[model samples]
Target: MSAASDIAKDHKLAVFPAFHRVADRKVVIAGGGDEAAAKIRLLSETSARLVVVAKTLSPASEAAVATSGAVWIDRLFAPDDLADAALAFAASGKEAADRAVVEAARAAGVPVNAVDRPEICDFYVGALVNRAPVAVAITSTGTGPVLARHIRAKIEAMLPGETGALARIAESLRETIASVFSNGTDRRRYWERFFSGSVADALKLRGEDAARRTAKELIGTREHTGRVTLVGAGPGAEDLLTLRAQRVLQEADVIVHDQLVPDAVIAMGRRDAERVAVGKAKGAHSVTQERINEILVERATRGERVVRLKSGDPMIFSRAGEEIAALEAAGIAYDIVPGVTAALAAASSAKIPLTLRGIASSVVFATGHDRHSNVLPDWANLALSGATVAVYMGRTVAGKVATRLMAAGLPATTPVAVVENAAHADERAFTGRLDDLPELSRRSDVDGAVLIVIGEAVGEAGANAAEPLAPLGALLEAA
Candidate 1:
């Protein structure tokens, strides 16, 4: 076999992901242009000793080196320049010079990153989401840096700003905690409690001392009190979930979720926690509510943090009332974490305002299905209420809902929007008059959850729906 073919057969090319400890180490940069200046600014944030080698530097590079206190070598790059360096960067803006530096760095056993030249690069500098001790790096194997940066921006927004401070607090208390809890399992459990409990909250709100005190108190009393938290998983999309709901999921020792709750949302819970699916579908009840209540009570009473994860806002047609009552009657402590309900998510996805000042001053949320009885809610008053009506689980009975509204003096021409799998990747919205709802729902082919919005606000949305809203990333791109 040919040398290249033999090498390819023996080993596949792949970029191994890793974090190099460059603190107090030397990093050599051979360039005098904008690319070199950019690397200098990034390396300045770290504790690395930066050395810039260029016969002449541009104004930008000179200013950056001056501000960063990087050592300047006013001479041509030499092979010995890579000696004892942790890493090397070649952004000379000249192909010949960059290639020379890369060859020298490779000879010296140093990893080199050649800007805009992936073929010669030993390492590619990807996007960074710097939360200090909680830094996240994203890369695309030198195929697409822009794509990597976009992903980084999304993660940066999701991570709490206080994460670094919380990490610092944990580091300071690590020795004390280790001493207190000699067993490794007990130490891990204590740290999990610390991260999910009032210590982290105190760090966010009341600062370091209060958080320290809270941590100390937790150590003094290594007691586990079980509680049930009713969390809303939101409308399909994981990002639509509230921060409080995410935190509670991370802290859960047991997650009890419904069929309506998406798997992506359920996966956000602590990895080691037991997951029990007590989901209820339209006609099928895999697990009955009475049985579910028993499970919650049983788990919580056993000193396990139980999470009753419901789809969308738990308060809105999610049977949260029944569960809350059950917990209360059993004297099990519980709390509710609100989430972005289907109505809100549907409206946002369809670009429809639920309530407008002149068009719809109030909004009414109601369920299409009534499990207690076949009798529906008062349609006449709701039709006359001059409020936007957002119906949950209404796809099956869209025809009947339309008929009741029209019979109650609501115009057949009133605009309606049916949003299926709101805020999800497969989300689709159909806009038409109230009379068209049944047909629209039938043609939608949506097997997932569906929400219906009917009123003047929907009519206005249909009018201006042609204009697409700008994406959140547009601001970052503009910047």
Candidate 2:
């Protein structure tokens, strides 16, 4: 088995880092040419104390310098000139001088932006879809400026100018409004309710007075409590998790997770949270379902928020129904946080859509590892059907399923895709004819989070696609 660290290095999707906004800060533009003038004008819109340093200034910049009385050092910019600045923009003579200014600014703990030179820039200037306080910045990691500007323009079209005005009005009343609710929980709920209501937009449109009146009329004195959530952890990978599932994981306290959940996702939980393992690796389920039930009930009964983290989405084949019934029977409050089912995750990682236009429109999720069930699946209803079929935990019985399915009318040449460690960084995919999938899975190095796909959709394979496996059982359950 590959180490988790190795997986992190592989199969990882791109994540964008957050950038701090320069709402009000000192900025120095170290030139007086048109480039410097443009930078200066943009800075003027902010609260930055603008300083322009250039031997010869542009007509526009010279006019601003004359009027505003900004200190224009009418001499060559020395590297030491940036000693006491917050941000520096250099568009001066010679690459050597610009490099010097950048190095000096770095030494002085100041951010420097070198015009048209991304390597020397401490921060890239992004195109803004401005709602002022609620502005959206667009950047392409310094690769595509035009693309970023285009995206900004698209965003600008959707966001109204009134939104900025509204944000300022909201900001003005924050101190007074914040004092009304001292409890952190109440404050969070209050804002959530405010944003969801049409009245928040009205406050932006009709001004603060209308918002205050509306808030008073609608909001009551009772404390609004946040809810405890129960979420599916997925088989292992963080990438396999649903967006909604990730959001809940990021917010919850006292996460009671199964052993199958990936540590990477657990790391995303609150650092101060109580993480108790309910059981592990699925074999014979170390913690019985009844015991897990008692834990969830007891924790939730105490008013401490709890999340029952099961690998994969809890709804499919998972006994979430029994748990939901338990929570209801115990009168304990809870909500379901759906996760990407193992089948979906595997399919996604394999780039094979479970459903396709005209080829396979309907999909069924079936279980493969039912130890107690003597009956096999309905071959007549399932075989050769024009639908994507996903089987969960069907590794051992995959060949048997394929053989029976083919005998029942499924063509021997039908395409099948099998994914091992689906959505995990160590994920590997195999594809082949239905007849050969069982052997492929047997030979694969995959040990966990396996899923099988069988349908005409498999025939729609693109380059760089996975091979196959006999994973009909788990796929059956997942569907």
Candidate 3:
């Protein structure tokens, strides 16, 4: 395998699947409250046989059970009740009881879902969009179900009902397709194009025959050879990703992404896309970059549409230049898709303006590379004019950064913000003056995609930090 193929495996983990199947299998629901009714409603279209065992079932739940003829134990469940279950769901209010049921179910080789409790879940009950043969699910990994449901509704709105019709038609004609495209790679390539285009739109506009004809055209246009696209994964949030990035991910033959790319971002690619995780964590070299650049260039030259998913905009300090250089040298077709970098995410989350009108109009982004030479950037000439300066991967060397800035005549008390794991849940931001930066960093745990910003713009943001953002948040602020 080429070096690019290996790096592709390392950086591709961002597009992992978020859903799986347990079709025509038995699942045990051991609860009596309204929770059981909700779970039953969700499973109404699924193939799983649901058994509800509770001391006292709600009247509505009992009615649902009666209508479905679902087995109701009408009492507490024993550990052995899970023996034949492929999956289990428990919603008992008692934490201890939920834990016991979850442990028992897992011991029985059954995946368990405890309602609203992340600690007890073996898997998760995600938000869903049911269109049969084409069901879609949106999950928050149990962090925010309401948010998940809202997002699922949006996704459901985006998908046309014709998608289900298209899926059914494909299934009915599967034998013929398999025979026509004998090789698995060719078959995959064919479907990748078929699903990518306006087949559903064509079927809605005309009929299945027209859609089939279009699918054939797509198959002819696609080569079975593999290609790699070096796409920026855009920080750690799925929403932070660009439309172009998602479009590429959907078409990616293989994805090599940074580890800092959120798990949710990785799940954006096609369900079957192979994902690899390369450590792109700032300041830590896990997969030496020479190998990654070679991987992208080699894979693309082979006619593969490989996506190189970085943590942020590929152009910003992200070795996009090096990879593009290799691709250009080899005459491979590729393009860069910009994304929300960690600095922007951090600045927005911390409510610090890297640049603001009058307060600090000019912004500078620098690394700590001058430390070995004991050289401080000319802060007086570059930053003394009230500009915001953002330092990427400079939190560990905060003391040196501050000393140089002070020497350059920037205020010792210039507002500084240290953001860790920007745009992610449980993200922490430390705000202080340059003088107190080192002590603040010591007291906090800064890990995973850290960034530093120093300037008066941060202080100006503090003036109206509580106010609502302007209509042009993306333009006015970096969020």
Candidate 4:
């Protein structure tokens, strides 16, 4: 077979679409009539310097030229007017004048558009949906102008007004993106998320500043290699999640979530995302912390978008520090997005304020056990400091916490509130004196995560608070 015959044949086009750089370049219009005005109107959207050469100006052309920043020359068209121009429009209405302008443009090597006379034109102007920095052009190569305009209208309807804003933000981050992602594949993936993912949505709904901020955050997260994000799952409630946390979940390639993280929250991630359940409960460790760290580093090293989804705030007793340290040691890019910790959710569900103006001036968060599973050192001293103390993961060490607080001068009659599965549909709350805290924490029906609150601030939540509050929808309807 001949070399040319071996190559597959491709369909040919009557006219190929091409975008020419015209910013700050000269554009000449030979007529000052309705046709020329229309072309000028389109060119006004660009940064091109317009020069209008005509013996007489119609009122419509005068108005268009005035607003379009075009320099008007009150004289007949000449070949010299096309000098240094990137484009020329011949719209004098008279065939003789239009032909002359087209001939001059061809001689000067300038592409000319002859309005309503495509046969003599060098290029046909398409119907444009002008979202600057993100334009969509529709053309039928002069064969069907009306059809191209109809297509342009459909596209205009589909795109948001803020599309240009999103495009401009992406353009601004081009340098940063180039520096962070070394390979073309990584760079392309990064831009795919920037345009079609959360950043693009943020621009349309929240405005430019929010979109730019989100774009920067996504850019800072992963690098040439894969990276990990430590996201807080927020007390087992999907709605309580921070916007940033939700965004990361949607973009994650692999989610390493805790066993306690509700399925509903995990379901918010991409449908095809890999889920690795490494949940650790009381004495049973499904995946050790060290192994979890190794998993994060390994997946990230392979250029995967890994999300270490933890229950509650990762910064507060969720062992996020160890994971962060491991990632840092391995030289992987990582970021943290905090969520609504259990203490805050528990207080909100029980209708007990963690800090009251005069009753409790300050609030403290403490895990019932230290890293070694021993009673937290000096935790009782914190309870005696006239501050509301919220204890996390304290179901097993509730008695120790209560006994030590009492021994350290905190009154035994102090109010205590315990919330299990806070903010979830099956949430439960119990309120009693400090001496009864151990019993409250050990309830057989409380199978979910537990949070214990001790101080005068919780005095108003009665024991009957165990009755789950009305759903938020019901409360809103009642209001």
Candidate 5:
């Protein structure tokens, strides 16, 4: 499968992830303490009619209730409190009080969450990442609530802040699109383009006015207008991909990717999307550049949303220029989505800075070899420019590069850091003097893509940095 498959077929869920429709419906919270206040804050974001029942209220609980405009019943929990309620929260803190609330909710056929009492609870509350109309709920089945929130934070970073606006726009255009495209296939394709093509791009970059104008141009058009997007896969790490790159991958009708792009990154694309591996590696040319360009033109001409997935930033040495030219020649529309380049990822993995205030003022990105597979012509000058040089795909010629740099008045003890398969779980980094770069690059264990960084700045490996961030999934046991 190109994307996630049906997990229910091979595994079972401890608690199914479901959204309860509580708009204008009563949602009871049988408490008036800190625990109930938390639930009140959460439910307040929804359109549900919140009702809090308790004999007494904490200062915080009273404030929350007042802010949420909830009906505060100044009485003890009872069975009638859950009457006509869609959902209930038994968050009274006291074991007996919580149990009483749970019993009442169960008798009323309402799903209930009993704070810190999972065994008796009918449902579990998950950490929510909201991009409204589009919400992501993450849970560890009550085993880890902290972990779920951490994951939600990570997802929140990955998703664009403007996604909710885009979703609202798409929702507004549904009927118009449905009426215009009568064929089911055409309807689905149009929506896909609406989400992944020029309209989506305009929305993201130019706001609703441009997005509406772009959509208006597409409305009622019978002919399918195909386009191509050059997406940077971002140094083999799935999380490193840009938000736009992820969107295009999920919406692509066909993904034409390189061999260096890992399976994890490729799996981000639509599951049913056609995958054409037209990758080019050393001594292997299963598909030439000319033919690859032809393929992009052909697919896009047929109204397919094509994603030309490349390793690292496509604009840098990915030969995106040739493809762009081909698309232009064919009069096809195209977009370019930048990615986290390998050089930047490699420096990050090695914990080194490419540019320092006094040590190094600039950084240069250079390929290890040219089209004919020869080391760069002026490799020595780049090394002697007093700037950090980040070399891509240069492992095979590391010896030649080191020799030339040393011969051109560059120091043999120049600091060098080499990272292979950067940002991946199996990533490895090596640091040494320029004299050792040849042996380090030639190591038998180096299998994946390699990036070589050379400069005095490589020696200053973020020694003054702050403490590292915590893992995304830390232990957080919550009911």
Candidate 6:
């Protein structure tokens, strides 16, 4: 089987996930015990008009009904109780009574959930990580509910508390966005930026009024021309990506990325965004630079928000200048969102200071390979320069780099650090003398991205110096 098909097979779900629009709709609950009260607490947060049928009401159940403003019927549940209801919950705490209610609800063509009874439940109430208008329900197919709730708690902790407020603001501004943009794509793009960018920050730091004002200003100054945003994807970790980069990704109508950009990073873009891999490796070019430039211009001229996602910071050896020149020549509007370069991330991950007072007072970021010219860079000057050197795209030429540095009168025993897949879960770092640079590069198992750090400051901060970084899942939980 094909890989996608195999994945699909592996993910065969026990229940199809869906959300019901129950606002201003009728819902029925049959019970009066703690079980029934629990269901009432869950549903009370929504706008559903609830009716409770129970022979007896415990203090907890009565209080729940009062708080939820649900109608109470002091009698047994009947088939007609489910009539015209969007959903029905059975929690009488008796097997026979629960079964009767479930059957009646099903017969009335309403989905039913029986508390603590999965077999009879047409649907289960999953643990919710509620950021209203953005609720995330976690389920385990009516089994392992405790585990689901545990997972939900973890998710809840990761989300920004003000996300719900931001969602509410977005809801209130939907009509305004639609009116301003007209096109669905444009409207979506605008909101994506608003949610991930300064508007969301304004909402969090100031208030809804401030956010609304900002939104209005953005709408008034909306750019009609297609634009290209050169986004830095950061060093193999989604969390390392900047808020502006995330905003641009979400707003893009098309994403053109390098092969080094992680799948998780690309997945941050709009679900409907077109993804094109125009990656260039050392010897192999899946798509040429000229073609890439043409594609950027083509997409922009068609009025699409184009995001050129480059690994690490676009300004640092990422060939962003060429793309910017292309956009300028074509008269297309464009901007840049800087990302955390791999060098900094590598240094941070390895707990190595890029520059230390007295020991290393300066830092130089240099690429080992020059794509435009075959002539090697001034390696002697770079080696002799009394500064820390962070080498980009140097893995293939590690031996040559070491040889040149050594020949330039640098000590063979200069501290060298190789960080592979910086800031990622499987990140690996190797620390040794400069003489072992080539061997370290060869030994690295990371197929994603590699960065080499050479200087006296390499292990000055000590090995494994920084606190472990959070994984991509933690970063995505907020979104």
Best by TM-score: 5
Please, what are the lDDT tens digits per residue for candidate 6 over residues 6-93? 9998789879889988999999999999999998989998999999999899899999999999999999888888879999999999
lDDT (Cα atoms) of all candidates against the true structure: 0.84, 0.72, 0.73, 0.85, 0.85, 0.83
Off by over 4 Å in 3: 1-153, 156-185, 197-222, 280-285, 370-380, 440-444, 462-479
Model 2, 321: alpha-carbon shift in Å? 2.9
lDDT of 2 at 24: 50
Which consecutive 10 residues in model 3 have the weakest lDDT in total? 464-473
**C-alpha TM-scores of all predictions:** 0.81, 0.61, 0.55, 0.56, 0.85, 0.60
lDDT of candidate 2 over 1-479, digit per residue (tens): 57988898766634344554454555677888877776776666565577788888979888777765467888878777776577898877468878877887888888888877887787887776666678687777687888998888766765656667556655665675688878887776565545434346577678767876766654464433333577877767665566656655655657888777778888777677799887656456577889888888887776556777878888887778878888888887778878778887777677887888989888878766565742256633654668788887777778777877877888888888888887777778888778876675476466665788889897786665564354665446645
lDDT of 6 at 473: 47
Please, what are the lDDT tens digits per residue for candidate 3 over residues 381-411? 6778887888876766677777777877878
Q: How many pairs of residues collide in model 6?
A: 0
For model 5, how does the per-residue alpha-carbon lDDT over 1-479 read when each residue is reduced to its tens digit? 52346655446676778999999999999998999999999888889999999998999999999999999999988898777999999988999989988887777788999988888978898888788888888888888888988999888987877778779888888898878778898887777667767787798899888998888787766567888999999998888888778878988889999988999999999899999999967788679899999999999989888999999999998999999999999999998999999999988877888999988898899988888888884756766878999998888888888888888889988988888788998787777678776674446667678888899998887642322111112212210
Weakest ten-residue segment in model 5 by summed lDDT: 470-479
Displacement of the residue 1 alpha carbon in candidate 3, Å? 55
- Which pairs of residues collide in candidate 1? none
Ranking by lDDT: 4, 5, 1, 6, 3, 2
lDDT for model 6, on a 0 to 1 scale? 0.83
Backbone clashes for every candidate come to 0, 23, 28, 2, 1, 0
